[model samples]
Target: MIRLALVSNKLQKIQLKVFDSSTFSILRCWDPHLSSSRSSSQNLHDPTTHFHNEEALNPTELLNAQITSGELNEDKHQKMVVEELEKVHQNLQHYEPAKSTMFTRLFGRRDVMDSPKGIYLYGAVGGGKTMLMDLFYACCKMPRKRRVHFHSFMLDVHTRIHELKKTISRNQTSKPQPFDVIRPIAEDISNQSWLICFDEFQVTDIADAMILKRLFTELFSCGVVVIATSNRHPDDLYKNGLQRSNFVPFIKVLKDHCDVVSLDSGIDYRTRSSVGKDRIYFVKSETEADREMDKIFKMLCSMENDIIRPKTLTIRGRNVTFKKTCGQVIDTTFEELCARPLGASDYLQLSQAFHTIMIRDVPVLSLKLRSETRRFITLIDTLYDNRVRVVISAETPTKELFLSEGHDSGHDDHRMLMDDLNITAGSENASSNIFTGEEEIFAFDRTVSRLTEMQTEDYWKQWDKKR
Candidate 1:
């Protein structure tokens, strides 16, 4: 009997619930009969076990069994990805042995050459693609492993190669080998049947898309298994667009590498966010939220004189930094600066980082639609695009605020985001987050705005004299 189980975190308690056949309705999840961990807290030491079926032998327990019995290599090649990483599994499954030749074995091959094995999984947004990749990762528990978000992993690659190129330019070194730096990591995976998982594997930005061929090709040669989940379909990747043809070979490489399994679960998992009634927390006081902003004010004020590294700022006590911020421009690599660089995981860090962002009165520029203005527009666009839950205290609402007037220009960067990823902004239906009878379009906005205005005023006042 084939069975699928779901493990979800509800009320901060991670529960492993079982589903019935046919409709997959909840059959049994929280059974008092199964008490691995005595306490309600999600314990790290709890027995993590899941039976393959009615058979008593649980896959997870089997893993644990191997761990204790001095068999470190016990089924590390196969793992059950916790539900959180289902999307990753989908991507890893992209390589299956059946539909693939020896060359097409990247995503589709069964791990061993001796057996009949191949599987692929592909899908759209919030459909638990990463979850599956993670499952593949968990199964292959080789000690030498790496799992990175696509952007950060690319940024690191770019950084290393850039340093090496600089050495070549200096003529101090005859030839700098960038491969030496990242190869050891790759070799670790190649040593055995290794696993590599990349989250949010989409390439629209020129900086990343341009280098995909070389970077991945290098890793591919080193025998590292490449598994990635993307918003783009393989053939249509970066299709019919600027400098997009350069990415064609990359698409081919990916196609040749992994068997494309279009899971297309046809069901969006994101809608289940409101599955059970969660909390609608309200501010303790009208100004309580403001005080929280003050905490941030104190930090920034303290650092005003310091020409700190752009990648070393802390937000709400979490180490936060920007990727490309420098000289007359705040060119940021939010991907690199993000807490974990793994998509939705970073959003939580961001929500906790800043309560209020105050942009004191700078001249309301009636500027033209230049690159700088466009980039700034892109910055804000990206911010809201991610549904950053913050109190935005601006002179005007986002649509009108900071917008240069009469700029009839359109930008590809802004429009590049697809509708699937643009999950509509969180609702303001007066729950605790919006205590004002659904009156507040945004619960966190007003308080954030008020505090931000005050802070921005203070910031300008303190520095204006020098300017």
Candidate 2:
């Protein structure tokens, strides 16, 4: 049988208890300390207080300012989403969360007031979902607020759950009541932040899919608001996967808690300009591309005063070796970066260690290389979010890197995934839609869009500023 295992051994050591398959129920109990905490607005500096003559603008006004300044093209759909976010921004000014302790939530009457509904913006790639959300997050005056990539956030969640399990296991003196760790974890998060903004929110892994309902149910109950951007709608999340029926309840929870908005303007802003600018992306033959990359690497190394040698990174107690390094730059290949089992944490560490990344020999992605494709997408997302500079040499143009054909239908990766899902060949569940390259096809649009944007003159200007 093909097995789909957890990537981390720490996660594998702790067995997560299966949750009930009924409609998700919110946890009503609250920590007294969190409920009695001071409002974040009191501690933070309001932008309005900075200038006596001008007040802070809401998300709508900020978006209009960008359009008027020619930073962004005007689109009515984007305006609609911004207006909705503005409402939440205005509501939070005078909003008060209901107070509840475990005692009152269980026995006595509890104070209850409605909180503002969060937002989930979904649409096509490069439709300005992230841009608009950033505007909202920037204008939000909440001191206890955090904005992060969704993949990085989930990585942290898994790590926290593993660490929590280890702590609970070491306490030999306490009697174990029916322990559900997600509750305490949610309470801890609520104590830290009242608002969370997530970019590129998605659910693909079974581990993440299973825990979201319980985790979000508790987070929502603690009165933590979320604003997220994604390419998929709530109902379309985790469309098909192993035991997906059990994961369906999260869709309802998300829809009930967040106002779903679509911001598709039918134009991909990232790809409006042509590629091959700034001499960043090389599309020549493999040998020629390698030569060009070497020249660039040496030039970058000459500019830096540090010594040139190999470097090793220690991540999560694991050592990863990169053969080429010169100061704040590293020269690596797609095989070393994406073809192996590296993940978001690994890429996050690499991005932190290096300012400029030179990657050579990126092969044309197909269904046979679905795992590599997924990893590549994650790597680019992490780098792009961090604003790290990337120089790439690929087998084809950036837009044509991922092929749409399905000639490798019976590949081992496809068959293994089907077997792991307990789907037999020729079965209804094993239809073309299940193990096909649909997700990769949809995700490559984003990868290509980001790659195109990374080559723009403006992107290079940002890189220069960082240097």
Candidate 3:
């Protein structure tokens, strides 16, 4: 039992059970039973005999220490926790039971979708969106369901459409045999009562933007209960002239199908003032790009590259491949080539032939636009989908390879970037030797380590493991 304190991101206080170090990168650990009630805690084992016993950390240091320790993801599990805590914080007299409102038509009819009595969590960034969803996920006791990110969720949808296309394409004469777990999963997903929870539910770009209706419409008609945490207001989603109007009917559909609620009651979770020493991701210059490339390559080299089975999968075409593995790849359109569906025979047929993927003409990571920028997203999608831990990149310094829509000279880009770097660096797990005799179920994620540093094209061959 590890009693955790991430003073960063609004000085949060949460508890978690640290099962083991086999797959986790726990930075700070403490036995819940032995935790001191006294606010001042110290590392007595430190060689330096001195300690800063400050009384109550300022918001900045609280945020910094929490940020530097890499615990922001855990923070997402607190929306409901905070709501539960808010009751305690206010010191209320009694518990208010959730009221019934089927007839009111807040979203839909009573007993709709067979009334599975599931949860629906929604909120803004740092507004305790994921926190509530994760808490419910941990506490819920139900058989048959799946939790996934919106990106991976869409990938599964793409894979499904792709596979359905294949299943029909084969035109098999035999009756559907004993239900294969994977075959009926797509159809089964609709029949069962699924408590789907999505984090960071913002729609971006043309690809994902187009399919919003068909995807969720299928899910809703099939009976999937969604609990989502988002940074945008439901109506305000897909902001700007991003062709969101095409998704308007789906927005109405979402509002009609789900119990929409707001959780904007407290402080911004990202605004914790106590975090100490801000960390910044470097933007590389043309002259020093070579040095940056080495830094990124070393990060990948210090990792374990291995195969992993995807938890949620799509059986596309006759191909036996699954579209999602680590389930991080998100796209609005155009399925990644590696994620193309495969049937049993189709998979066997393409084994040695589809071995190596050749991503041609990858661009340098920098402010300048590169031809391969779109391909980078595809590369990331395939790597994440196939669970390919070992990625041979011709591109160097990830930032250079994935060029951002360069600064518009307005809006707090610098500050927002600092916040993004601070948040991502704060959210990741540290790399240790994560490989042993035990078969690895998850990817080693050399991509993140490389992505953390500046990517340079000068040493492209260095990223290849074969050399």
Candidate 4:
């Protein structure tokens, strides 16, 4: 009889809740090994005991138990994924090799062993791929393991390459080829993590697409195993891009190195969950709006209450402070963001720091508020591009957030806000229109369209991905 129990990190015993198997619909999760009774001699403080308790549970059994306990929605496809992940975990456990290091290379050289094949799980948004990956990552006992979002990982890769190039140039050593920097970066990753799990493994950026083949080839050579989850299949990654033909080999390498698995249980759990949740709010009173936003913030933060704290981000030597943040969920005022002279870089930095953002008091973007409106447009575009989740309390609905000032009062058409802007469905011309003499208004139109989409359950699905 496995009953769900929770133990506080402070070593306090918590009451166990048992649900009748017939009526197990409401669910929560904790370590299943926790029992209502413990012997006086049991060493609750032992780290080894905690580690063993985690290992006692299998991914499939744990997930099934979670479902049975009403902690998760039961889905056959998700259970199948648990089985696949279990295999990968077992393979990793059985894999035998000394940790890759310079010390081993010099003093204790050993033959390179074949690394275990990893899985590439692909599916529609909110199908529980991330949930399974989280389970797998938690169950992995390997000391050399790392799980990172693909976007952040690529950013690190690019940053490291830049630093390496600067070093090479400053030292006046041998001229390094453009491809030469990838080896050390991959080697460093291999040395640090034998098992690498990437969330939302996308390759839309041309810079990333160009170097992935060489980079991953080196990674594989150095014996790093990878598990990644994505909405796109390996063959379909970077579907149609500039110089896409050159990026095809990397897809083959990915296919050969990993088992591509798809999980679509024909239901989006997030969408189902979002049935009664409000994503976009139109509020006239700032006080009520702030209170509602705070409630949502607390809900997203969950039981890790202390994790909610302010974060200061340094964007190109400028210090920007977010008033409230819990893990990757952030809360800040629209005035704090748009009133400043921040640009795309600042918003991009914010996107990297937080996956979900709650912006309070978004006023109508009239022509008089041109600078703030421009900044707001830039911020939203960056957030949309990075797939960040945006929750807002605005003075009006999204469609009406931007309006002509005094157009009804017979102001000049050119003086009207909408007259100066010519926006369309999907174009980048909106940012330049007001001052750059560009006719395209699609940037703001697309921004408005994105605002609508972001409010949907589909866009919220991607919010689960790490920032």
Name the best candidate (by lDDT). Answer: 2
TM-score of each: 0.43, 0.82, 0.42, 0.60
Provide the overall lDDT of each model, using Cα atoms, as 2-decimal numbers. 0.37, 0.74, 0.37, 0.65
**lDDT of candidate 3 at residue 54, scale 0 to 100:** 37
Candidate 4, superposed: residue stretches over 4 Å from native: 1-55, 96-98, 101-110, 173-179, 274-312, 316-357, 361-391, 394-467
Worst 10 residues of 1 by lDDT: 430-439
* Greater-lDDT candidate between 2 and 4: 2
Q: How large is the C-alpha RMSD of every model relative to the true structure?
A: 17.7, 15.2, 17.7, 11.5
Better of 3 and 4 by TM-score: 4
lDDT of 2 by residue, 1-467 (tens): 01113124453233222211110010000111212332221101121222235467788877776676556678998889988999889878876454456775456333446667899999998888887887888788767788888888888888999999988888847787667788777767766776899999987787998999999988787777889999998888877655678889988888888999998889887787554333678887634877767766765564355778999999999999998998888999999999788988999999888877988889998877778888998889888887687889999998889987755777777778777777887665575444766777778889888888887544543432233
Candidate 3 residue runs with Cα over 4 Å from true position: 1-113, 116-124, 172-186, 191-193, 205-211, 240-245, 264-467
Flag regions of model 1 displaced more than 4 Å.
Answer: 1-120, 170-194, 275-467
| lDDT digits (tens) for residues 1-467 of candidate 1 | 01112222361132222211311111111122232333221111112222223243323544455456543232222333222233433444443222223453343322333221122344555454554554345554345456656655665666666666566568655555443434433333344434556765655466667777765664566545566666556775544433566777887767665656654554443332222111111132323434433333333322233232453455335565554222212222212332133333233334233322222221222233233332332333223322221222223432343332444223343333322234123322111111111111221222223223222221122111112
Task: Give per-residue CA lDDT, model 3, range 124-217, as digits (tens).
Answer: 3345455455434433335444555565666565566667767765776777554222324333454453556675465644566677776666
What is the overall TM-score of model 1 with all chains considered together? Answer: 0.43
lDDT of 2: 0.74
**What ranges in model 2 sit over 4 Å off?**
1-54, 96-112, 174-177, 273-277, 416-421, 425-434, 463-467
Better of 1 and 3 by TM-score: 1
